[model samples]
Target chain A: MKIAVLIAPAVHPVSGRPCAGEADLAALALAQRLSSQVDVWYAGAADDAALADYLARGATHIHTLALAAGREVLSPLAEALQDYALVLCGARAGGGDGSGLLPYQLAEQLGRALLPDVLDLSKSDQQWQALQALPKGVRRTLAAKLPLVASVHARAASAVGWSYARLQQGKIQRKAATGAALPQVVLEPARRARALVAASKVSGHARMQGAIAGGEGKSAGIVVKQGDSVEKAQVVLDYLRQHQLVDF
Target chain B: MDFSTQAIPRIDPRRPWVLGPSGLKRIVLGDDSGSRDAALLAHGPAHKPLRSSGPFSQRLLVVAHAERGQLDDAAREAIAAAAILAGKDGEVLALLYGMQDAAPEALAELAVDRALTVADPGYAPEQKLALLQQLLQQESPHTVLFADRSEDADLGRRLACRARLSVVTDVVEIAADGVRRRQPGAGFSLRERAQVLLLARGVAEAKLPFVGKGERLQTAALPAISEQVQDLGSAASPASQLALEEADLIVSAGNGVSNVPGFLALAEALGAAVGASRVAVDDGRFSRDKQVGATGKTVQASAYIALGISGAVQHLQGIKSCRHVIAVNLDAAAPMIKRADLSIIDDCQSFISAFEALVRRERNLV
Candidate 1:
């Protein structure tokens, strides 16, 4: 299967230096595991310095789609990924438009099925299987036909160690743009978010109770000072059951 | 006394007495306006009742999934956002996907004017999308609200892409006119209202000041569409293999625990992820990633069991976000015991054995 790993420009969280996102690197690693004919594709604004980081990590054939200054990459990226049987990318971008909607948009544009938050990927008998990550450490296995788009989870797989040799051997080819122009985004300074607390309608006494006890009226902690190990274990079990933490 | 022409002045509650013209004391009895206050005191605040009196001129849609027939906190928040934005003239309609274990009448508490349940089984996103598009065509809601969590996150993005509308995700604050979301870098960007809104958790108060009609709308059968993706149901991964931050339950060991193998066994028995104190990691008893403290990973697990851990300030800081903490320590004076919701004063090894035995016996019985 021919796999395409979508790469996006990323910056270090603290140093703000150009770097690859952890999830995107994970996607690249997962792609390498599935097939050796994996090509790295980058679209949008230029960040060659970060692309170099992907080269250092294990990306062999890197294609940078030449998108005009302010144009969107949906149509161009979709056209670029037309040949690949599978398209894999991080569930979210590291920097630009961190809305995590690019994959969904691409899947819709290409009219392909999208398997998101994939922790692992494999292929067997002409079908792509994905281990999807759900909330609270739950996982769901999903199967889809060829020509599918999957978004790699951040915890999917760790990227291979950086190789200075790989960086020298990797090739980054610039390709012509084939996308439409998008609307200009207006940038403004971010503002502090205010928590939306409803107007209190209770009496002054009830309001005081809320203020003193804090919200959600949970009972205070229990200190079991006297009990044998068996009895204490029973207490723990009872508490766990009361909270529905454990079934048995 | 020409009482018909002149209205009598009401007595203030602060001073419930008035001096008569004859210099006699006249005591004011119960206040006529005190009935509402009495009701408030007896029944706890009365809802302001925001039933949209006028015809539905505009509609605000809230799309959510009810797990086991109960609306999660995030889903409730989305409904509240729609209700707040709908105001009096506009109607708030909720489209629920998945099996509703409870009756639709429960939506009355959420201020939902009308609810349509998509009760079809299976993981058919395409069919659900078709139904959603059909509903969208039938009632062109001004704005569709969705919770930015779990399955709704995927569904909302899919809807936005198919509709070709730019969706504002992780919207922390929403009002009738505008919405705000966190931008790429640091600050928040306030944008004009979009057609689809993916609301973040706690963006609105679920407790409403009004009651809705709670009318359950009848829906046609799901539109048949060939689905490309197949869901094979949930895969079971043992909790011990899960990451600490992602695990719902964690069993942590501290310096007081001498038996490392026993601690690991207890964690496996309890079906929980393993965590360690900084001291335990420093002693090379556990890996660096397993450390949970100020310098280690911060965990937001629902339940955390601290075995033989004397609650160090740094260790407490990491697990502070944990919903429930059970401390098993020799000393009741330990700081962990104070921070723990339930503290059992006992040796870590004995407690582990007893707990494991209890769990095994309970499982066998079941």
Candidate 2:
């Protein structure tokens, strides 16, 4: 059975090198574990000299869909992923427009059943049984036939580190996407942190209003009045509910 | 203006989700006796009838699902946002699902007049999507609002796609013309049409000026969906301290907690488990399991003594559940000190020693 894993570019925290996202890498590992015939696909620019990180992990075949700019990846990826028996993606992007909307949108575009936040996946009686998570760590068992989408949760499986020798031998195949007719949009840079605002003069009421609107005040608890250390400790202990938290 | 002012989508009741189970099924959630009025009185009789014509004809539907019959924080937030956006003309209606007990009275206490319920629990995602689609088409609502939850966002996108309507997900603000969110790219922020919006939490949190005269409307019949998905049940999430979530008193340390051995002793003296801030956890001073912060674990301790922790906002979020925070840090201006009930400015080692001595003396006296 052919299963495909989708990957997005993520910058390594310390080294600041481009690599696949952690959860996405977990999906790749899961796909590789499920079967040997795993096709790794990415939908953005691949400019790095060593794009072999995915190859080093477990991707035997890597397909990079080259999208220059302005085009929605939804269409290009949907066209590229039509043949696979199963599709796997990280539940959501960890960062960079992390709206967590793409997996579901992609599922809709592909016309397949989507089982998101999948904790574990296994084949049983010719059907794929998925362990799905709901709000607050609730787990549900869902089964579906082949030709469906399953997103990998962060805890799906531990990722195996990449090997140097494998990185050298892994091959990545690039595919040029058929561009759409829509007018190209100008690419924008990432938003930087909010610009620092200069301190402004304010009157009494306005200053009070700013404090309330800015929400700088704590809503609960009283400040401990300055006093002797022992008395302060008593106040602290009084605040601590012994039945709830303190053993004494 | 992009809000649904056009034609309503078509609906077929025979959709794979609406049909009731063909076989006997266990009641997954909700109390049948309390819901005795729920099935029949879902559309409250005392409430004014919803308009199907004129400028005010369009209905405002706020969709929320409850766990154990109480709406989650996000759901309540969405309800508030929807109510605020509805203004005075449109009838604010709530589509509540997954009640495990009697029909909730909370919504009725809000400004909502009518509530549609599907007290059935454990329905599959596909079944939920289908039922919502039927309801949307049936109501032909002018505006629809849902919470920005994982399931709700997925279902909203799918429903939008099927109905050929525009959907705005993760909307932080709703205006007359468009909705706004964080800048998707650089230079300027992005906006979306206001037809269907999935509200992000923490924005709208006000109760209706008056309580909703809410009544339980009969939920649509839910047929069993694809059995491919099963509930494996829930397990407790792993936390830093085994008892951190249950602990009512916590003695936490941060980067300033240099003396690990002494700190542990002091915590033991206070009968408190050790919790570390993100700084300490990141510095390798404490294991990830002992980290206390938003990304790690949010403790609900009654008394949280934070030592040497210059509380970051993320750390503060983790300790928001903490009832009483006692901050001990050298920096008086640290954000944590402002939030703490007891703010002590002193050297970390000296303060811990003095506090420990005081605690020991108090114990000896006892």
Candidate 3:
């Protein structure tokens, strides 16, 4: 089976230095585990120093579709990734637009099944199965036939460390590609976001009560230092019941 | 003493006089601060007057799924943003992906003029996307809003990409001219509002000065498509197997907990993820990934139960976002006791067994 891992240029959040995103590196690591016939593909400017990090993580060859400024990557990526049986990418980008739409777009354009936020992958009975992560520590398994795309969750695997030896052994092949012009975007310093609050429609007394009682009209916390184990447990249960965290 | 002699009146005319129910009490009458309360008492809780009566000129769309019979927080924010943007001349339309179980008054309170619901079971992204595209083509709304959540995010990106339309996602602020979002590396990005927008949480106030029409619209059935994907049902990972950062409820241990198995069993009974303080991790009783502190994984669980854990500053910092903290310790003067909403001074082992027994009894598992 052939596997392709998609990577993009990432910079450190604080220092603005080149570094591989944790998510993308996990994708590479997962791809390497699936099959040894794995290749790393990048669709951006070829000047990124972070490309070497991918090599150290175990990709022997890096294929770059060198896109100059003002070209969208969807079309070029969709075209270049058509033949591969399995394609892997990060659930979301660590930097840049970070919309995490490339994998979905490519899957849609190539007419392939897309499984996102995949934490583990394995092949059996000529089909690929994945363990997908959900919110609140829940997980769901999904299965689909060959020729699919998956976005790797950050927790999928621990990223491989940087090695100078592997960097020397890897190869980079760059090919200039062109597509649509970039959309107009302007970057600026961030401002505070406005929170959406439902307008209060209570009496002044009710409002005061809410304020004094710490909202939701619940009583303040209580300390139970003088209770036995059963009584203490009962108090805890009552608190949980009041908060609606547990129901019986 | 000249008691019979008439004395001059000692009343001062400049003094402020307050009239009470009776002359004996000093209570003041007609207080302006309580006027609102009085009015509410007379008329009950009145809804805000409608922004517009009818005959809307334009329309904005909000797409989301009803979670547990109501729109979740992120979706409500998006709806509110759309409502604000619609103004008096425009109308806000909500497109829901699940059953129309949200209360009508709640929808009206958010200024949702129209609601269209499509009820389909399971994971059907393709059909949902197609329905959305069809609606977009038909309505031609001024702007479509979506919450940047798990399902909506996927649907929004798919729709935008399929149509090749420029989209703005994770919008933190919205103005008449453009939207703003925190950029990838640092700073923020401001871009002209696109036809489709994915709003970040807490961007708009869902409360409005007026109620919406809150009328329901009928939805067309989705066309059947061939199924190539198989969903293999969801499962809850064991508490010990789950990562601390993603756990909603966590049971953590510290230096005070000696019975690790008892702690684990209690966590399992509560169906909570397990975590450990740095000291416990260093002691090799728990692995490094289960550690919760500044050097460890900072958690944002809804409820954190600390067993025999003295709250260190770093540990407190890690649990700053937790809504509820319950501590079981031997010392009432411990820092953990001070930070916890509920504190119990007891032996960790005894408390663990007692809590577990209560949980099992309450759940009727015994």
The most accurate candidate by DockQ is 1
- Kindly report, for each predicted structure in the order presented, the TM-score of its chain A compared with the true chain A: 0.89, 0.70, 0.86
**Best-fitting candidate, measured by lDDT?**
1
Docking level of model 1: medium
What would the TM-scores of all predictions be?
Answer: 0.81, 0.63, 0.79
Which residue segments of model 1 deviate by more than 4 Å?
Answer: A201-205, A220-232, A238-244, B1-56, B66-72, B97-99, B103-113, B117-122, B175-177, B205-224, B253-263, B276-288, B291-295, B306-351
Model 1 Cα RMSD, Å?
6.7
Per-residue C-alpha lDDT of model 2 across residues B185-275, encoded as one tens digit per residue: 2222345555677777555654333355566677666655664455545543322233576565678999888988788877767767679
lDDT of 1 by residue, A41-132 (tens): 99977756668989999898789987777788988898889988799999988777678999999999898999999999877787878899
Stretches of candidate 2 above 4 Å error? A11-18, A44-53, A94-98, A162-165, A179-248, B1-55, B100-105, B161-164, B175-177, B182-189, B206-210, B223-289, B294-316, B321-366
lDDT against the true structure, each candidate: 0.81, 0.66, 0.80
For residue A204, model 2's alpha carbon misses the true position, in angstroms, by 14
Error of 1 at A188 (Å): 3.7
Better of 1 and 3 by DockQ: 1
